[model samples]
Target: MDFEEDLANDSEGALLEGTGKVASNLSDREEILQSLDSIHSQINQELNTIGQAIEHVDAEELPNDIEEFSVGLSDYGAELSQFIDEYRHNLSAQSEYFETLSSEEADFADITDGIENVNETHRAMNAHWYELEDTLISMQEILANFEMPTPQEEGE
Candidate 1:
């Protein structure tokens, strides 16, 4: 059978029947713990299966996966961090504007400026969101195209 089927079968068999009811007393808690233990065992078994499968995978594919992950991370991580910092700064400035606007001495100019600042910050956030989304989509496409080479292919 395929990996997914094997995993599903193993996991399904590990479930404690009627586990949907909430645990109230000590006995129920013990049952829950037992269920958890069963699940953990299944997870460990599946992890071992996965490790064995990885061992059989083409060695070159591993480096490609790492490179893909690293490139995507490097491309987005710094820019996203910087953008978040700028957003935080803008939010802090907006908070100060709100504090000022709450005062009796605050004028209409302050209100307009505050609104403009908030709108600008929102626009920047939306723009950055789209860029991040595009980056994720591109990376997902790369992942979709990637495949573990079969033993036959690896042999060739």
Candidate 2:
């Protein structure tokens, strides 16, 4: 083969190799997308369950309940916020890794879609969390304002 023909064959070979890589990347992207979808669904389901539980709570007044109820909610909110912060940090790292991978592989371009799905899920999670926090704070405030009736006042 002449020099030009040899160079043309080498270029064609490189293109085929790159094509193989792209196909493999596409398969991997599909798997990642499936996993993200599953996670999204699971998060939504769990949040729904939590919402249902909160909705069904029966509030009743009891002796010496104010102090314990306020303290319990404060502690629970702090712990739950810490856990969610850690989870979101991990998710941010995962998104950055996927973004880098997508930039490197042409066939992995769809990875951004999966990442966006995760972002949407995260937003929904945060919304629910914040709503719960607000509700807890409001409950605490309401409890703080209550003055237990003295025996004389109760009798009247």
Candidate 3:
């Protein structure tokens, strides 16, 4: 019989049931870890692009009143870049730990520990992202308050 049928036919005590559950948990956890890694990479790439854009902004070209806003944007971008680096480091370490668990027969405790680690990292990343979002919103409001020069006045 197939593995699923074998598992279903097992009339043993709770041991078989527990084993099947652990196997399922491991599979699900692995998929989540993989997805997290992919997301981390994408975020890092986008942050890099933002950093580049910030660097390209010409402070001298901005109106005197808005020059400070540009500086604040640069500072925020730098802080975000640093945070992303730290998050990536945490993700890499967790990935390595998960890899080690996979190489051996992990017990329930080990699986649980790995899952907890992933959850904690996710929480930390989410918190940092929220902070960044708030900063961006503030910047957007500041920009919205600035008066744009009319195209007809630009040539004069």
Model 3 ranges with Cα > 4 A deviation = 1-64, 145-156
Q: Tens digit of lDDT per residue, candidate 1, span 1-156?
A: 232232234324311221211112223545544554464455455344434445666566654565446545554555655655665566556545544644557677876877787788779877986886687578668657665554445556
Can you write out model 2's per-residue Cα lDDT over 48-153, one digit (the tens) per residue?
4334333443233223564455455555555555545555554555444443443435343455565576678668767766875686577658657654433333
lDDT of 3 at 69: 55
Ranking by TM-score: 3, 1, 2
C-alpha TM-score for every candidate: 0.49, 0.36, 0.50
Tens digits of per-residue lDDT, candidate 3, 48-145, equal 54444345544453356554554576577567666657766775665455444544365668767876887898798789879877986776786676
**Which candidate model has the greater lDDT, 1 or 3?**
3
Best by lDDT: 3
Error of 1 at 79 (Å): 1.5
Q: Spell out the clash pairs found in candidate 2.
A: none
Could you tell me how far off, in angstroms, the CA of residue 127 lies in candidate 1 after the best superposition? 1.3
The alpha-carbon deviation from the true structure for residue 33 of candidate 3, after best TM-score superposition, in angstroms, is 15
**Rank list by lDDT:** 3, 1, 2
- Candidate 3 or 2, higher lDDT: 3
Residue 154's C-alpha lDDT in candidate 2? 36
How many residue pairs clash in all the candidates, one count each? Answer: 0, 0, 0
